[model samples]
Target: MNSTRRDFTELTMMSKEKWNDEELFYFQHALSQLLQYVNPEGLSILHEINREMHSRD
Candidate 1:
């Protein structure tokens, strides 16, 4: 897991625009399950995944 904002940003940027449909669907489902218990960082990751998913629309 990324310990700092910079690393998290780097990871997010690296992963953005890279998820295929199946991967995005998997992440969306997994993150939705984590939504109830996720920390703020997890929320951010989930948000990014959702953003990518929506971008496909």
Candidate 2:
């Protein structure tokens, strides 16, 4: 999967354990919308986090 998708998958997995189904759904939906306008710096940060998460896997 792409890094972004992978990172999101990892996040969803973690959130599933911590949040109720409805809460998790809204959290992911909000994040998905927020990501659409992320600045270059923010995108880089997310890429870095994705890399870190991938390395752990």
Candidate 3:
């Protein structure tokens, strides 16, 4: 597999562990940035769109 795909799988597995509060925060932050890059702005836009959709209901 490509390095990005491999790294993402590893991140998914690693994040499932019971990390300390600080470690979990850092891991989530890194994962979010990685996903943002992978989606080329889609992630942020989707989040904003989802917020608006939910607010409208």
Candidate 4:
């Protein structure tokens, strides 16, 4: 058997999409820059995950 978990940050982003457009937009823009500063690979993975999540909606 295998188990998987979502990180706290991922969960937070998922919930943020429920907010109004401007709020969500700012949240995303901030996260994008922060992710780049933290790690380029992290930003790549984050963008990929974001695409998958949004595609489902």
lDDT of 1 by residue, 1-57 (tens): 323233334545667576566666766697798688888988888888889888889
Sum up the clashes in candidate 2. 0
Q: Which has the better lDDT: candidate 1, or candidate 2? A: 1
Q: Give all candidate RMSDs, comma-separated.
A: 7.0, 10.4, 10.9, 9.8
> Candidate 2 — which residues are off by over 4 angstroms?
1-33
Deviation of model 2 at 34, angstroms: 1.6
Best candidate according to TM-score: 1
What is the alpha-carbon lDDT for the whole of candidate 1?
A: 0.70
How accurate locally is residue 17 in candidate 2, as Cα lDDT from 0 to 100? 46
lDDT of candidate 3 over 1-57, digit per residue (tens) = 223233334544543333333443444566467674657454654354344444545
lDDT string for model 4 (1-57, tens) is 114544446655565344444444444576677874757756665565466457656
Candidate 3 residues lying further than 4 Å off, grouped into runs, are 1-17, 36-57
The regions of model 1 sitting more than 4 angstroms off are 1-13
lDDT (10s digit) by residue, model 2, range 1-57: 223233444553453344334444444455457798877855654555444444545
User: What is each predicted model's overall lDDT from 0 to 1?
Assistant: 0.70, 0.50, 0.45, 0.54
18: Cα error in model 3, Å: 2.7
Off by over 4 Å in 4: 1-37
TM-score of 1: 0.67
